[model samples]
Target: MSDVSTRVDIALLGIRGGSTPVHRRSGAGPSDDGHVLIGGFGAALPIRSDSPYSLAGNKLLLDGADIGMEIEPIGRPKFYDLQTADGVSYEKIAKLHGSNVLATTVVQTCIRYGEDERCRFCSIEASLAAGSTIAVKRPDQLAEVAEAAVRLDGVTQLVMTTGTSAAKDRGARHLARCVRAVKAVVPQLPIQVQCEPPGDLATISELREAGADAIGIHVESLDDDVRRQWMPGKATVPMSEYRAAWAEAVRVFGRNQVSTYLLVGLGEDPDELASGAAELIDMGVYPFVVPFRPLGGTLAVDVDHASAPNRDVLEDVTRRVAKELQHAGMLGSDQRAGCAACGACSVLSSAGG
Candidate 1:
């Protein structure tokens, strides 16, 4: 359980399942993954039909040999079986992540999701086009589904993200509304809201005021060149702006309550990416570092054929970043809600980040 090399290997290489497993196909933040617990911690491993890694009973095998690791695939949540009063499926509103986190994309389409401008790593609208999720999830629908998830599946927190919008708020206002509505029903539920830096910094305060426990203003890579190449549209928002937003978010949500994603691979220098993560830790933002999975339909996979980072590179950066987080006393578990709290997507939690 202490050694997470196997966990990291499975995360990127994926696991071939003997039968259909608890997995998500697209849109969701940790999409294209099979939800499972490896040594009692939630993990999202890609579900690959041809992966050398596979599960047999409680044992994990790599090329038909047990690797001395155990896994338990998370079950499909009960809320997924219900429907809202208006007849939209509950799952279309929200879906279970890890074991007990309900996650949803409030807006399924983004203004920047167009081919040339799209973030190469994102498939935020693929689910919408496939009819798996609604384009816009109403406050009432989220509230109903959240209630069911918490009641029937023991969901402890909610992670809500929205595709970028054309409005000045850039989708923060609707997120605040969603958080407020969910809180009205599940009064004690911890909620995390993710969005681009709003045009108005004041909107950050509004989200905190609306009962959000934590926030993630994700900038996938700190290297501007990488930003431009990987997230052409997001790079248009200057790093100064991201710093401003992170500072304001920390001011409002407090230390360790604000987080961002720093993706491994995408051609970033590993040392510099780790240094950038240290800077985020100094700014009171948790950098959720993860290896890039070549998920189907993402521009990285279909258009460019990008693969996962080299295993040594991933472990090296993870260790370096985890050390800085330890020195600064920033652990993902300290965040009340969102990807950080779940710690399923990154190996940092296992490294004590």
Candidate 2:
């Protein structure tokens, strides 16, 4: 049998998403949140009972063979059932990512949502449109939710990502304010903030000062041509700006404390993506390589079912990048907080990153 991590990666890339899911959580998916937990790993795997993979008696079964892994749906957090003093549902204020990370989009509306400018893979506002979350989560509200998530559900860390705003700070200022609020309430909780690079690189320091333990400045694809094709508005920022922000973030957050998301199945060359990840490792950035799972309401949804990279492609890139991470002595687990720390969305940890 193949190693568990490799098989899990293959299942995620090619599983039939249209089948009934035994459990579901929210972000984007065939089901609400579209996320599940398997062997301490969090993934947005397609829930298909009839496919070669299925949940049976608490074990993940593959082609009638016991994969020797136990997988279960992450139950909704208790905080989700509560409401703020202002009457907002806790879920609207924030949602649990993976099992223990409290995650929210500080600002749901992005300046680039305009038809010609939006990233094809993102539906950040779809949850807002579906009435599952609010456009802007207030600092106090987030603080309240974070406190509850920790007290009620044992949430250990928090992730706050925002849609790009028109401000020169690119929403980092707002993220800083929210981080302060949450930290004031939960001083010991590690936190990560994600956003596009601010026009003023100095704001990176402000984010760190505001109590963010780690940061993620995501450049989904390093290829300029791919960026132009998939994220027209974001691509306008230029790789130079991304490089500056990453350098500043590393200086502030320290090595392995800053990370980025590198999505596969986006028509980028597998080797090129791996090489880019190696470069990021050299810069002290953890490259979070994940399979592109198309959620409903994004431009890519139409192609998601057919466009998911084959298993060979996913494993090749993942193992290669994992090697680069190892050589650099960068492990996602060292991040202390953020997506790389949670690692439900990627298989690097399973590969020994």
Candidate 3:
């Protein structure tokens, strides 16, 4: 195997081994403050499930150790038990993320899925496979879920991300419709929408006009080689296309309101990742630096993939980027909605937001 792949595999094995219950402990102390800490990383664990070996474990590791920060997981929303008139569970439609953001995948299945084009890091269909959610959520269902998550869970924002559809718009139209429906119910709620850069840039205006508060057009990696290896199908779309889409998103969403995901440990050099982040920030976008987690059932898991940049690397990159964001006066607080604002999945929010 190549050097980068070998490094990533080792990292993945370490993470899996470290997350075992025997090796885990609650990060309890005066500093705990309801947050869970593991392996020098800290984040709020979900109140509903105390099992420390799941995604929450990985999140805590990334937060406390990687970013030198602490974040609290979002508690169970009151809407989890509620069902729509048609008998759809609200929680399955849209679940709360972080402290006050409701997130959902409108279309669980992607056209690129099962094809060689699938992004290796993604397990968009796994939730569906485990029966955690329905294959597709109707616009009305999402609006209903959002309303309850806000009223009961104290959710203040919403994030709608969709699997790619057959259309070139890549399900942006459905996302726009969902955003509109949810906003109609809660006009003051901040809503963020995420999707691939569509074949038509006009869909961006459609989303903004539909009342979305912000947008995330994630190009997980700017390094073409890493992109091809990590997200084969998505990498087919040129970086120039992503740049144009980001420019238009910033134009519509305004400054930091536009964001993208930049996963560390994808074989991209640390300096290169930081420099790419700088370019994105310079363009009025937030580069959300996240440590790659190999979700169950993803191609990553099948290949036993892992992230190479450890906590030290993550901290260095986040600190530098946070400093840049501060200089630009672009706190995640300035964002109306989305992961950057929730700040739970990544420690960058705690680093400086």
Per-residue CA lDDT of model 3 for 1-353, tens digit only, reads: 33223222223233222222211121100011123233333242322222222334334332224332222333345788899998888877876554566778888888877758888777777667767788988988988888887788787888888888989898999999999999889888999999999889999999999999999999989899999888888888899999999999999899999999898867788899989988999999999887675444566657756533575676677777878888888887789988787665465755674
User: What are the candidates' C-alpha RMSDs?
Assistant: 1.2, 2.6, 7.8
Q: Looking at candidate 3, what is the lDDT of residue 163?
A: 89
CA lDDT of each prediction against the hidden true structure: 0.90, 0.80, 0.71
Instruction: Determine which window of 10 residues in candidate 1 has minimal summed lDDT.
Output: 17-26
**TM-score for each predicted model, relative to the true structure:** 0.98, 0.92, 0.81
Best model per lDDT: 1
lDDT of 2 at 83: 100
* Ranking of all candidate structures by their TM-score, best first: 1, 2, 3
State which candidate has the highest TM-score: 1
Quality of model 1 by C-alpha lDDT: 0.90
The C-alpha stretches of model 3 lying farther than 4 A from their native spots are 1-74
163-279 per-residue lDDT for model 1 (tens digits) = 999999999999999999999999899999999999999999999999999999999999999999999999999999999999999999999999998899889999899888988
Shift in Å, residue 98, candidate 3:
1.5
Please give the TM-score that candidate 3 achieves against the real structure. 0.81
Candidate 2 — what's its lDDT?
0.80
